[model samples]
Target chain A: MSTLPLISCRGLKKIYPLSGVEVHALRGVDLDIERGEMVAIMGPSGSGKSTLMNIIGCMDLQTQGSYYFDGVNTSDLDARELAALRNKKLGFVFQRYNLLPRASALYNVEIPLFYSGMYGEEVKNRALAALSRFGIDELADNLPNQLSGGQQQRVAIARAVVNDPLVVLADEPTGALDTTNSLEVMNILQKMHIEQGVTIIIITHEPEIAGFCPRKLIMRDGKIISNEISSSDVRSKEV
Target chain B: MSVRFRVLSSFSIDALKANKMRSFLTMLGVIIGVAAVILMMSIGQGAQQQVLSRINSLGSNLLTVMPGAAGQFVRSGNVNTLTLKDAQAIAKLTGVARVAPTVRGNTLATCGNKTWTTEISGTTQEIADISSLEVELGRFFSETDVAGISSVAVIGQTVYENLFDAGVDPVGSEIRLSGISFKVIGLLKSLGASSGGPDRDDTIYIPVTTAQIRLLGKTDQSVNQIQVQVQDLNQMGTVQDEITSLLRKRHRLSDQADDDFNIRNITQLQTAAQNVTGILTLFLAGVAMISLIVGGIGIMNIMLVSVTERTREIGLRMAVGANKQDILNQFLYEAILLSLTGSFFGIVFGIAGSKIFSHFAKWSTAISIQAVVLSVAFALIVGVFFGYYPARRASRLNPAEALSFE
Candidate 1:
């Protein structure tokens, strides 16, 4: 594998402005991940793990930092540029699924395609292919409210992968589910990383959830405390 | 997404449907406002037209002389200081059609066992010709009575009924105005009441010379007014100039000084009445729009609440690559859509209400195209005006805090 990183961070810091005060969310963080690497972030409450994730996901700007995504430096990028990069190079999955309440599973997956301005049968084909790959293709017409928590999570995963983004970013994707459901989500994430050769990054406090990732990183007091390589569990060569 | 209007339009429709009762209430405001404008304008227009037709009935092309500092005057009912010679001179003018000398005053008339009070006018054969006095019994006072100052008279239907004890033909019957006996020679047609319910038939007429020499004897050379008629409408300006110069020279008023008399065409009065209706309609429309403004406020309140309720949804959108402008546009689209739908229903109600009112009012009503167009535009504008603040607040939400919002 090339030594060049798909995502690189240098001296990233986040300070929030409160009334007559300032809140330091992230302090002096430096990190990187190679292309096609699967990593998990573990942190306690108020550890600024979510803040770091927001910055990395391009949903927020770092107060002081340099972030290079796929070799393009994001220091001077505007809000529009951040959204564009997030749409094309990054994907997000949340614990609550966050599918549009009025839309069906298929429509939820097609939202990324709408932003990309892909028209005609092409958007449908790509959206259907993404859902079918996750084995939720038969439930494509069901609304998020009509689906089970695990099924909704599966739909969210399909939505994340619809654009074939460079990195899949998940924030406690299985935090609201049962153990069986949690394992099912982890298994899907592992299969996508290995089979599709896509980079994956997940944020969670659970050690077992981190165990499913090929690498693990822990944060405390807004600082990364440990970074370690974990055993890659290649559960399937096909399927 | 490609064509911004279509996307925004669909979203607005959804907003309108989501709050059915609120949307209907907003529409009600618009309906009442627009309908009032139409109704007020129609009534005003109808009344003005009726007055104009009455004035025209007095003479085909009459010009009334009013007392003014100059030629500019608006009212036809005001008393003036013009006389019999002025009428004669106006008739002799190059573009003159004809002229009628008129003397009007309030007086008490009495016959045997009957006494009635009403307006009394002393006029000539020209007045009879111009006023279209139908001879229901005997002939109107002729040139003989005017020239010879005979005591012959013509009476309106209302005066004949109230003042005459002898129901027989009033022709040759005697009556006294200020105690001078005059023979009633003719009866006028029943012109009915004016729109305000004043009895137009409650009056009497006699030859100008007879009233001047016998009844309303006075040394003042000036008669009350002179009614002049032009041959055609296009000849009015020339006749007006001739009358102006004549009056100015007679009164010895210089070019720099204003004339003591004013000349007005009935057409101008008609136009002025039309303008009054137009202004009334505009004022009513302005008042009605207040309700629409209130409706817009309701929309803003609801939108603000919606933004607060969907904070986490906004955060999710931002995280999924939606920008501030996109979010702003989304809410604005909803606002415009709600208002547009309201305006549509308002138009429907306004037209229906106007139709129902016109039948009862007995007035000719026409829906103004400008009012309809302006109201719809205003409703949409109200949407944009009131819808902006909440949408801006939504777009300005902090992503981190919003995401963490429960």
Candidate 2:
């Protein structure tokens, strides 16, 4: 494929006006992520790792930076264009599993495809296939409330990859899970990366969760302080 | 776009179904408002129809000439201003078809053991044709009876019913009117009570000359009123103008003086009554519209609550790929569906309510297609008007903040 980075950022900064005072959520930062890479952004609460994730997910604009996704400048996109880009190119997973509480797992997986303008039997078949891939096909008709945390996360992952987006952003995907479920979810993410070559980014404050990724970026005070490739054989041990 | 709309509508339906009780409560306002509008309109229309029909029974292209100025109350002593000669002169006009000079007085009539006080109407045979009176049992008095001043009468249905027993033929019978024995020659057909007016069938018809000479003991040939029939409806205004000028000239009235006689067009009275009922209908509909607006406010209130309650869901949908327009459409469709369904039931209840009211109140009621269509259109407008604010609010929500919202 093209020898270009899938996501590139330069001097990204984000500030919020809270009760008449400027709160700096993000400082100038530069980062690059290539295709087929699994990266983790590690930081505690108020460290602005979530802010960076929000910007990278195209849900918010950086105050003073240029963000490029798949070589396209996100700063140049309008609100509608950003939504379209998110729909067609990116997927998201939240710590809460973020599945629609009222909708069945199958319908939740079909949401991205619906926004991408695919409908009818094709949408249904693709959603079913994604659910089966995540081993939740039998629970496709279950609502989010009816499923366990691990099953709900699997449904969320199925939905994130249902449209085969360019990248999947998981912000604290294991934050609300037990250790057994967290490890299982991490293994699934690893298998998705190694087998399907889907780019994955996980944001977490736990070192154990960060250790599951091949590359980890540590953040402090809205600035990325370190970027290192871990030699740990956690993937082989987990898979 | 169509497929997207379908999906959005389905989403709206699901949301509404999730809170069935709340949705129904929100729709209750619209239902009551529409039903009230329809019932009021039907009542107004029914009253107007009853009035027009009663006026129609008096005869088409007909005018009544009273003794005083229009809208002025005339005393019994002033009732003799219109004379038989004036009526004869009116009949000789180009557009005039027939004229019947009449004098009426209430008198007690005795038949066997029954005695009822009824009106005695003195007129010529032309009244039969002008008033469209039918002879149920025998023919009306002939011209020979008028010339001879014979004390023969044609009894109306109400007078006959009151003076005679059930199934008893009053024709060829004798009844004492105001101490004068008169032979009944005919029986007039029954005419139901006129709308809010006196019972027209409670009168006895006799020769005008006989009443003036024998009963009234009047030496003059003056009469109380004159009923004139016109040949054509289009010639009514011309004929009325001609008669006014003729009466003014005959009465020797000056240029500045108002005419002594008052001419009333039956059609004009009908038109004025129709206009009044039309206004009543509009007024009633307006009041009902206020209720509909209140219902719209109820919808807006519920929609606002729904938007707030589903903020997290909206954020999730946006994260999955829903744009602002999609969210707006979903909420708008919900409002529209609520109002439309409410209006449907409103129409049903309105028609049934009107029927029940008319049955119990003994008043006629008419429901028009225009009314139904108007209400449906009005409901749709209300839905859109009230639905817009909440939908826009939901669509404008910030996805990032919304997702993080508790």
Top candidate by DockQ: 2
Clash count list over all predictions? 0, 0
lDDT tens digits by residue: candidate 2, A1-239: 25559989999999998999998999998999998989999977898998999899998888998888898888888778888887887889999988877889999999888888788999999999999997889998989999999999999999888878889999999989999999988888888888888899999988887877889999999999999986747656544
- For each candidate in turn, the interface RMSD (Å) is 2.2, 1.0
TM-score between predicted and true chain B, model 2: 0.83
Model 1 chain B: which ten-residue window has the lowest total lDDT?
B71-80
Best by lDDT: 2
Q: Residue A52 of model 1: what lDDT?
A: 90
Summing lDDT over every window of 10 consecutive residues in candidate 1 chain A, give the lowest-scoring window: A230-239
Superposition error at B118 for model 2 (Å)? 7.7
- Give DockQ for candidates 1 onward, in order: 0.52, 0.59
Instruction: Show where candidate 2 strays beyond 4 Å.
Output: A1-4, A231-239, B61-98, B103-121, B132-140, B148-192, B199-206, B209-225, B229-265
What range of 10 consecutive residues in model 2 chain B has the weakest lDDT sum?
B72-81
- Candidate 2: CAPRI quality band: medium
